[model samples]
Target chain A: MPTSSKIFISSVAQDAITHLRIGAFEELSRLGHDPQMFEKNFGPWPNFQTGVDHCLKKVSECDLYCLFIHTKGGSMTSNGYTVTHLEYLRAVSDSKMMMLYCESTIMDAYFKFRWIIAKYIEEFKLSQGRMPHNNEVVDFLEMESEKNPTSGIPSKHQIDTYVWVLLHDIVMVKGHYVEKLSWGHTVPWASYLSDLLQQGLQLLPKKSLYEESSQLALAFGDFTSFAKQVVSDHVRISELLEGRRLLNRSIRMLTRSEITAGPVNGSIGSVKACSAICLFHHEGNSLTVQYYAGDTNGNYDFEVGDPSSFVSYTYNNLQDGVPGLFYWESRRLFYLTYKLGEYVISYHFPEDTAWSSQLYADYTDDIINGILNTHANGMIIELLNSLIGGLQK
Target chain B: MSKKPTRLPAAQDGWHVQTTANALSPDKTVIAVNKQGTVLHMQRNGMSAIGKDTLLFVPTTRYTDNIIHHKHQRLNELNNTLTGLTVEG
Candidate 1:
């Protein structure tokens, strides 16, 4: 016994195929089938959100999905697919029986060119208030009218034929590839449609049309379960990675500068001197230090004199002139002072860390004693070396 | 649901009889079985025998390859019963 099934027709709006749609619907109904199309089935919703919802629900309820494609891809939506394209995907996901047809005929250049000429003339008349008297334009329009006798744009037959070919060559239904129906040449739409109905009806099983297939239910069930598990795992990984990133950033900020060097002897412009090096760990502090050693004459000007004049050795400012100059000085956190006789180097280390403060005071006292008495205690030098070399924390 | 047409095949409840022959013969007669464990003798016009004659086997005319025939018939019947007319195409 034969059965009637719900058929959903999907297509972009094409003026030429109105009659075809009507004819197909009539014939499908005559053959004991219920055909549903957007034009009739979709209600007048206030917004497209509701309208799309209704459309998709109807598509899911349908037993057969028919697609019509032409050259136009149609307007894109937020999901980057055209409305008809989304419907096609939904049908596939639902595992509904699907048929695709694409128009394949390329419009002849001569005909197309003439149509273009005719369009230009019509537009010119509207804009210029007179018919274009150009001989070429007149001749082209006349020729196009005589040869085609239809709208210059894609004809309904051409569009339908293209859709037929597209479906035949490309679309896949269920797990099997779709076979293209040869609707080209002189094959009339009615005859092709008759064959389509017969073939379609034969393929369907003799069961309730609305009943869900067991195969689809099982496939979707497992897929949904697996997808949920994957999403859960992804969320867990993201949380763990975020915590690790925060911890690493804090550690990096704390150890921004962790190096110190040199209590070396040298001479600057025949004046005797000594120098030491340390890196400031705070932001806005220059990460380099330069000292001129043995400047007893005090006759060598530091900035104005040519750099070669001072027997000065620069360090930490490896690539540039002057380091430790730009850091926190405006806040009065940085200071420098020097004297010509028995030159003493002292620094006021911030009292924030007891170990670093004590180390700084001890180093400064040793430098003073070395300059004033000219006798450096070997044990004091060793203790200063150990503190500077070891990790303060 | 629309009512079945008078000329269409009669509804066969829970039974889809087929010829048991290796190659189905073209003759108007064939024997088949249904899932209900009943042997059936089928003819081109109607069932010749059904379940040892316990059930009435009236001949029906609706037997075509049009798969959607029953569906369309049901839809027509629903429309008619609810609205007193078939929906226009």
Candidate 2:
């Protein structure tokens, strides 16, 4: 069974029309959730103050805050905040997961009301020194329209479509001024809310509820051992060592980070040890690099022959030189070279400042990873062959 | 009694003259002799007034050539302006 949650539903009592509020509450209960709505739960208290206090207490304890807005704005409290608005404020303060749904349809002279609200958006912007959120800005606008009802009228369809579009924009892209507001028919609204709640529930730790057993522990141990064996069988110890060296060298070269590095896993360091050093030079707002390494005897696409016989070869219509080392070709270029019993050094450079900002600033490790992963040896070999192969008579 | 001593005409008087107006070119000289024998000769600097346009008789040349013309003017002015100023011994 799903974990039962207390969902506090905030809406006007007048929103009971077509059973919108009650329908949502009933749906939540049917889905194994405890729905807290004041409309059905509020009973005759000794005083109105006592009733308000009881409602506030209930809202404070809710796990999720579900707010539905329709035509009626509801009665204002002593602080000039609507009861529903106060509930929303409390929910935000408590950081409860919130789901917002607004109805598109409104009755009683919708056109004149829309015009007043549209004018008030400018007023709100002027007072706030920035544009107001699409949701509340319209609400404030509606307040102004009600005060001065004899103005240009807007079509009902236009207002409804406008609200729907605003809601769509906020829902699709998060971190907007207004977050997660949906305006549509009832069927889609319930489905969307259910999915959102389900996603939130999945983020909760399900494993914590399961009891530990000796059999489960044995199974986990076997799985981990098998996984490690498979990885060792496929990936060479040399490649892992090379990757570790590259990560360490690259991390040391960073002056200020636009891309931060996380800790390198210890598995690579514990395996076959080798010395591979890579160096970076910041020359006039561009990066120049050199990578030096020895004996890479994994099945690579481009294999290094006798380093003494390494000739300066240019191929594929590129600037002619030794395939790997000490060749400068335009901006953002790579070169590789090998020396007998010494080291294989490969260098790559940024072409210009613009390229450097993108490559070095954001993707420094990603670019380096190409030269150091499981396919590192093969990639370099392939790179050299593609260039050198072009030189064949 | 009627003819008060009248002034006699000089020998060079009564020379009928006509002025021909034509734009002068810079690199060539222009010489014109009217029917009355009044001669006109025009030259711009050492160059003729054939094609080059010049406000004065001096030939109008490129701005670059003016550096050679007044190379000493700027130095002379600066020296005169700072005549009293000198480096300390």
Candidate 3:
């Protein structure tokens, strides 16, 4: 009983990982893999050294270490955060510890930097032959040459099909965390992603090569044909929800402020003096952002300010300084926000989109199922993934 | 009789959905509204823009004896009443 190929999940295992881990596991199981054979759990270690030891020991028990690289790995160089770096260091002794980078969508400026990192990672792969997608890495023009086939499938279609088949083989059939660049699941998901980018920007592919690639989903198994399939099977992912959220709260405290010894107190260079605080509550889908602000100047300034507070909510989109596009996308419900660099942006979506409830029920089912079949194997589930698919009935 | 939809001026190819509403509490504030009809509010940071939109609405909560319709709006009126105000980023 080769334990469901114990693959170690890495990276911060937060937002990005959550979206992919589970799908990866389900895909593998469909490929005839033992669903409970792989071990996804890792006992919490107290320190970085202990965690590394635990992680490394776990890797020793598996055939491959599936490392998920999200953005720039981590800031904590000492912690098990550098587990992938350590795996690379130990590559000579353990070449089986393959290092794969899960590529992310990045701006053009960062693309060149990503290339540099990919090159460095390739040098560490320790393989002699050039991998499938590396031609794009080696010379941008080489990609064009591969795209131009005299007949049959065009380059773009072949490339997409190449990635689609490769991903299905590695994830769905081979049941291995290992994958080639031809598969978008592995690092340098360039081919599959470039197609997605082309579609998103409303830009057509360089040729009909890509048009044919759309046939991949239609044809399944050996019997299916490109045209024989009357309907094209495509997957639609519902990411953002739209609707009103009756319950949601967000708070932000001022980081640095000047507290004056004078009467009114919060005096920022002779403005209307406010003392104490200001507060706002965005009730329903409609919300008001209120904060307590104190200002001090003359005695009357503080007097007028009081335990000062004010609230404001705008019913009009124009008043709120919000775009009118996603109103329906969010289903007009719960609030969603993302912090990028210096910008803090927020949006709202319907509450039903929250997967936690479904997640909780599934967890309960897993617990009951695991207890019944305590065959010492305990279930090994991947965290999350899209291509790997999830347990969908 | 047939019902007709009210056509707003400069009606683009998009529908107008309300995101935030504070009309109930005449004494409240709103943070932001996006194209998706999502209302978001935060404290301290007055400069918060979540999504892009053509029209922006900010209720004047702080009105003083000298300044009408709150300070920010009053300031805008002062500049806009004449040669339209140009807010520099």
CA lDDT, candidate 3, residue A232: 21
Please provide, for model 1 over A48-125, each residue's C-alpha lDDT reduced to its tens digit, 9 standing for 90 to 100.
Answer: 466566777778888778775554545446644456766777887776766655443432322233325434644676
lDDT of 3 by residue, A245-330 (tens): 11111111111122111111111111011122222233443233322223311112111121111111212222222211111212
Report backbone clashes per prediction. 40, 21, 72
Worst 10 residues of 2 chain A by lDDT: A262-271
Off by over 4 Å in 3: A1-3, A29-39, A44-49, A79-81, A97-99, A104-111, A114-393, B1-89
- Cα distance off (Å), candidate 3, residue A212: 48
When candidate 1 is compared with the true two-chain complex, its DockQ is 0.00
Give the worst 10-residue stretch by lDDT in candidate 3 chain A.
Answer: A378-387
Candidate 1: residue A149 Cα off by (Å): 28
Tens digit per residue, CA lDDT, model 1, B1-89: 00122110111210111111111222343233343534345553343323221211111122212112232344444444434322222
Of 2 and 3, the candidate ahead on TM-score is: 2
Judge candidate 2 at residue A320 and give its lDDT. 25
Model 1 regions lying over 4 Å from their true place: A1-3, A44-49, A106-393, B1-89
Ranking of all predicted structures according to TM-score, beginning with the best and ending with the worst: 2, 1, 3
* Candidates' C-alpha lDDT: 0.36, 0.38, 0.29
